[model samples]
Target: MTSTLLSAIPRELDVGTRRSAAIAQFISTARQLIGDPSQASREDLEAVARHLETLGRQATLFPEEDFPVDQEHPAVVYRLSEEADGGFALYLSAALPGKSVLPHDHTTWAIISGVQGVERNVFYRRDKTADPARDALTPERTVDVGLGNSVILGPDDVHTIELQGHQTGLHLHFYGRGLDHMPARVVFESRAGGSYRTFGPPAGIRHARITPQDLKAALADGQEIALLDVRDAGVYARSHLLFAVSAPRWRLPLDIDRLVPRRNTRIVVIDGDESQAHDGAHQLIRLGWTNVSVLAGGTEAWAAAGLEVFSGTNVPSKAFGEVIEHEKQTPWITSEELERLVRQGDNIAVVDSRTPEEFAAFSLPFAHSVPGAELVYRIAEIAPDPETLVVVNCAGRTRSIVGAQTLIDAGIPNRVVSLRNGTMDWLLTGRTLAHGRQTPLPEPSAGHLAGARAQADAVAHRAGVRRIDAATLQRWQESARQQQRTLYLFDIRTRAEYEAGHLEGWRWAPGGQLVQATDEYAATRGARIVLADWDGVRALTTGAWLAQLGWDVSVHAPATHGPGAARVTGPEPVRVLVPDSPAPLIAPAQAAALQQSGAAVLIDIDSRAAYEKRHPAGARFVAPGRLSEFIPTLPAQASVVLISADGILAHSVASGLLRSAKPAQPLLALRGGTRGWIAAELPTDSGGDGVVTGDDDQSYSPYLQKDLALRNAGFVEYLEWELGLVAQLEREGHTGIALID
Candidate 1:
């Protein structure tokens, strides 16, 4: 691997004076340290030990001794100095543990070099219900790696490093001039446990000499930038922007979660004083946030820049407000019940109906994005099971609440509920979020036509229809071919037309665009749709697409239409009645109650976490993959099992295990998942470490590459940043290699 090791330590710093004879002295003493690093003398290692000991505070790690003592974990660390490069910059860092982190971005490009040892980087999505960063601004994202050879970092990237192999290490983190202005950090999250956090400009990072008037041109450029007010709430209440989120320098954490959750967006912090905004941005940069430039003069500068301001009074209603109110509130699945469904592999569709931008910003890690406005427009992209439950959400109450009700109002066959209080409530409760946007989805869940599909059973099914090698699917296709049926198979989703692999002879008539282009694919307006998708969303969207095209259609589940859409006009509802069996599916809650009295045994059909997260406290982690082995271990006295998991496959596996041993224990499928239990606020814990061994699950990455990417808009600045990071990683002893890209 190509490495960009720290190549220079100049004799004279850019300050036009020799801050110290350190670099020259280092050149003279380099051989002793590198040749026999284990035998380096105290005097020779003085410079290296100074930073760790003092840390700008005459107390810590080595406070009792002449040098810093070995510390397993500590607080903030000063990473780099401006003298290291010509352009204004510095580096700082902190240690993270306990899996308590949120994926986020930085304020500018930084040189993050590892020290002492290697660390593992894990990215996560912000779970709104658990975005600790809203209060503490945690960083989270889906996993992404640029280079494998270096323990170095670059601009706009956020990650958490756990000292790998040796258990502990250090990092010489670096930040460019622009990053010195952040005031706070923000993270986005969802109830399903996904998150995305962003570091924002602080009140301190603003250029002291620049003025608000200097930013007028950039703002006038139209959507090129944002002016964030970081004054106290009272000050902002007195006067602020129609576009701003009452962002006081002290409130950057709170406001960022509600306003800007993505690092790609450009924002400038403003306050009564420019220093606050500048420092705000500076702090944000140290946290790995980028894309911010503080207001030169705060509010005064905005006025000087000739920008418009508005007096208070546009805040939306909070719960019981006059502007908006909740209608009939629907109950959501509990964590236990959700777990039950997960194990059973029951059809379930969890949707984050926020804006796509918002969804990208943060949402449930396992859930798919179904932008609110796009709900009715994309129902067909969800699951095809008529019994599947669909949950929707927005940032807070309004959209999520409204979206859920809208689905019920439509004829969606599936149960639909809104994430309680949306992401805002999720964060308030201190739950964790996942950052899944980092990787492309193996299966598409939410799409435009998907919403429409939710309204009609046949249409919805067709919309999200996928042709597996199942006998039923093959039989259907064979029947169609023998009958000379012209099955109009439409892939009603956008994105790529089956990036993974699609069935042959499939036509792409994305539901979102089909509303306007149906005529091109309609072919006499009598074509029967054979919608397709990885998750059956295409079928639902197709029905909606047909409705918009004026054709009556059918869909999966029920929530497929609004007040007016399509009408089911073809076949009559077929009601097939079977003879009553000895026993039927049992409720997970009932099972839990029984277990409390030794009346039953709770069985988990998912990963240990899915069950142990909040299932019946005594539930068994009888995973589907380990059914044969687990079956022998179960107690014969337990007669009933509340089978639980994320989907139906596990349920089937559990049922098979029972069959192999003379079908003694009756199994009841959990309707939802662990969500059903947790919704009840039932007791739970971090038990049951799940093991995955299939090809679908990865065990390890042979080569874990830690890398950084800098926007080369200014090559010189980018190189400086790159070099700075090289030094930081080198100091920490990370095996970092660099590539320009």
Candidate 2:
């Protein structure tokens, strides 16, 4: 059977194709050993496990890009091979830090072996004193499984898996049968005092198939659906359903949780064909996402149905911006006109309607960073004279037009117009941009605050944005916690203001960036969005736009004196699971001493840019995620010390290193990282020569490309795409977006 399968495959093929061929051979051998997986003996299972581990050691066949770790779900499982009868199933599991699975029984024999990083496996034993029905279990033993390690389990063996710290883990698992066929698997919810609750028989996974026409109908009826294109980001950006979000299959585990927080939200995945979509749907189900479906024929079917597919990121928001421009005839001036006005010394206040960072990077001369929602709230302060001409600009069309119209709609007395095509056009027309300008719009004066508030309130109400009190917000938060629905709470203020003071539980999403990248802020299509701000104008204005974008949005302002009214200070905290035992920390002086005396090998795990800026002399640079690869290269007795920009990353790296295959030795993280060393006035080297590992950790957007011509072309292509969105949307028969009367 293996020979026959191999003969069907082409002799010359890609690594993935070759890997598939090898998988077929491995499965054939496994079948010969196990005979019938359900009746396989202990020796048979052990033999099969050994073969699987040997196959797993061929890490070159499994690229890390095929398994991305994002902010969504911490782990993803890729099906490597499975028998026709669903026996002898094999999977590649890639897990990022902070992943924890409850004690669970596979109901079949299984073997797990590591290819990279560390995975802690804790075996559990059912308590003899407890009733079988109680499902009570206690930890029996724990093992740190990494490279050159494997754990085998019987059909009824129960175990929990955890990945701690910052590194990602790549492991191979061989199971008696595929997960889709395992309807009787048991998950033990262990509690205090050895008590446990059984999740009972697994809910049978199902992926509903929806045709392109039906999906269009659902959207036309304004049904809440997250149409996700599960293709690669680059591919998805080229062409995708207008409303579909780019939730790549590889990134689904890392991004799906945040992109579509509600597991039960209607999620439809699409790829080139139904193959990837079906796989993505199954993975989503395994990750506890209840409502998932596959597009019947994926993007090809949609295009075949005569529905126009869009080319760009944030299609919905960008299209809506175009639609608004078309409907409202938002006034605009070309780059030439703006330059002429500037040269004539006209009474104009150029407001960059983008984030402060973007405005500071490259903005028109004399332009102040007023940002998106702030255009309405602070226009009164920016262009105090009603006769002043206010020109709004963003990187390109969307925010420029939207921000300009926002001011006009808010009844600002000034004459407002957008800089056509924004900075992109300004550059294209041979005009220069000013860099590092720090003029941000200030708060509205006491005299104009009331008027701005009233205008914003009227606009929000007109757009059907609801105003919720603190009590209602609390109820919604509780309901969201209970998983009854998905709710997103955003403080629509500038980061500076948000960090200075914000509601404790709310996340800081600056109003402009939130609008610019709505998918990033909220992935659940039907999820409720609640905006917070000290004053009502910013939240209301932001909510008004959100409502226009077909979101169920509400604005809230907590009472001045109340239990939940106190504002917290500092940046929002990130949540990640730390190791059971803390990473050992050595103070900067001690670490320096150790390094100077050749007792410790100092490794800098900060970003390439940070490492090149100023790292401790003689320190070696390696990307944190690739630390495991570097660990084995050192001498067996080499004392390792990790350093990052801050001590936090060093601690995480150190914790993950302890679980690697390195020999037992004292491994310590530099306390306070490089910051502490620099603060202590330690000697430092400033160059990239110490970097042993190349920089490829981050993906750059088209606009951020280093190639000058490519960047310019990207800007042009992007602007053109945005301009064409409204036309495409018009051509489509069904759309959820609707402008308010």
Candidate 3:
């Protein structure tokens, strides 16, 4: 019976299934041997290691073909399980040849069992007489770990492994606590009689893995789980798991707060590649996520397991909008009907509820840009007459729904409706869009202000939004600092309003955009957020949505006098203190002369895209991150002049180069940088030469690409992506978004 169970499965069955089954057995056995890693005895850990070695020896358990070593990312980690409190983690690691790991302590009990090839493990012992502040590691012994060979390390064990042989190697590692969770680990170097340094572990952890079936079961059981797809927008628009929110891998750390909000929420991340999913899960864990996991095989495994996948960005939010529209039978007007109404001189006001840039690019005739969150604030100004009809629109349906509903919820007396499907639908119906029309909302009258204030106050009360005076807000700010919590003061009004006059110390974040992309503005989950506006309407409306989103939000009304009084002027001048360096500063003309004379090589330290746009003639682009590697590539005798968009980056780069051993040449920073050169009317060029040191930091949108076919395809895919979001939301279960009647 055991032989039958261990027999090789058919080739048709995915390798993920077999690997998952083996990992499940290992998890079960480990749990039985050591119920809780933190409380487990040394003997218990050793017994668990022995069982793992037996499993490793079974060819059926860990087929070599299933665990291929990647050459690019040599260490591929497959997490099997982790204790709830992060006390322990089990994983399968594949290491390719030419890998050499420096000597380091795990800081916790760890076990390793080899399944393929060979690895040389060197053990190290700390010197008793060494200073406590520094690390002094002495080599003790070596062990050859081949197939079925196992090594068990106590909490204080230190070792290093090198895969010097010609073949790739695979091993299973179990840690008392995941490496990422370990606050500090010591690394040793044998340079100049050896020195040691303490550094944080790698960014990610070997987070728990879940099978598609398990995820499906969890959803069926109504578990509150956040399924995130960590892929680029283009890929996410192509296909993703149902109800999965699009939080690209690169933006996960920045955007996680808005998507999940609560660190304790159960999260399952998926990507096209297992490595990316694992890395993303680790990043989340590193950011204080307590319950995070990765899908074993990503979307492929989920599909293979007969689960549905979806497509698009903001799938849940878009879908929720659709549900609200359908259930409430939200009022909407077709493009043709709206055009007819305009032609007939109907008493209607059209408002574009998108970004100002988007509205400026193209908009409907007679439309003014009043973004979603500002709709309630500026509606009275746009349509003072209670009988006037109001129409809201965006590039698509979501913002339109939100904008129209916001006004409706605020008890605005004007008849309101969303432009069905927004601009895309208008274009499909052969309506020509007007470009560069800057129609501004009229100044509010006394009646308009009074009505808007009353409506906004009502909505805020309904959303349970608290309104604090300046004194109370200051108290909260001071309390937050004392408690080690974050407090964000955002001026939620139009950019024009913010720039013309605003309160000191309040950073400008427009109300509509803030609600749309809360993650971009506030990173700290559960942080206190205070919204401020000249008029009470904008702040209250924006505060309502933030409060609903689970933020500890409040609206602050500026005082008539004192520190909270609004400032009526442009932004305060910023004073930056640059570090004094011995390196010389060259003027634009002097640098130009040096370049022409071939005495100095210009290296731009700004973003690759910015550098490519415009830079001093003969300038080579080098990203700041690749400065060390790029310095060695430069001619040792050539005087290097570093410049950035501004002088800040230039000064910083020059300072670092002066300290480095390489570049054996005189390094200088341009006095003002590329902006100064441009201001001085110096010769500039736009294009990259043969020199490139690192990856470009900016990613261009597929829809914005020059290729007509690609752009058109992206648009088509985007529309389909948006269309499917409503269905996906219904499948996932209703998200707790309130649509006011």
Q: Which candidate is the best by lDDT?
A: 2
Cα lDDT of all candidates, in order? Answer: 0.41, 0.75, 0.69
Question: For candidate 2, which ten residues in a row score worst on lDDT?
Answer: 198-207
* Inter-residue clash pairs, candidate 3: 240-310, 319-726
Q: If ranked by lDDT, best first, what sequence of candidates would result?
A: 2, 3, 1
Residue ranges of candidate 1 with Cα displaced over 4 Å? 1-217, 220-226, 251-265, 273-275, 304-306, 312-741
lDDT per residue, candidate 2, 1-741, as tens digits? 233554554554434434555665677788888788899998887777666666666666566654554576456676655543456767778777878888887888998888787888999776655455565667889888777678888888889889855778888888888775576776765521143444542222224456778677666543346778776565667678877887755345456666777655667788766656865675565455544556777888889988787776777787888998999999999999998988999999999988888777778887888889787788888788999999999888999988988988888888999999998898878778888888846878887898999999999989999989888998998988875668988998888888988888788888877887897668767679999857879999999889888889998887788677798999976543342245789988888888788788998875666787789888988755456667777876668998888777677657645633333667888999999999999989988788876543322344455577887887888888788877887797556576776
Write one digit per residue (lDDT tens) for candidate 3, span 510-536.
887777656446644446788885687
Give the Å shift of residue 418 in candidate 1.
20
lDDT value, residue 297 of candidate 1: 50
TM-scores across all candidates? 0.23, 0.61, 0.58
TM-score computed on alpha carbons, candidate 3: 0.58
User: Could you give candidate 1's per-residue lDDT for residues 1-741 as a string of tens digits?
Assistant: 001111232322211011112212322233333234334444534433333222222112111111111344342343222321112343334333322333445544433344333445654333234444342234454232111222223333455545444323344343433343333444435323354445553322122122455454444332323456655444554555433444444323323432443332345566665545654554344333344555545666565556654433222111111111222545454434544565687787777755445566667665677644345544545656767788775554545654565465455667787665555445434444565463233332454345454454443343333333334445555654652222454445443434333444455554533432333343222224555543444345435434432343432221234532233332222221111121245555665676788767666654443443455566656434334445455566665564544424334333434422344455555545455665655555555543322211111111111121221222233223322432333332211111110
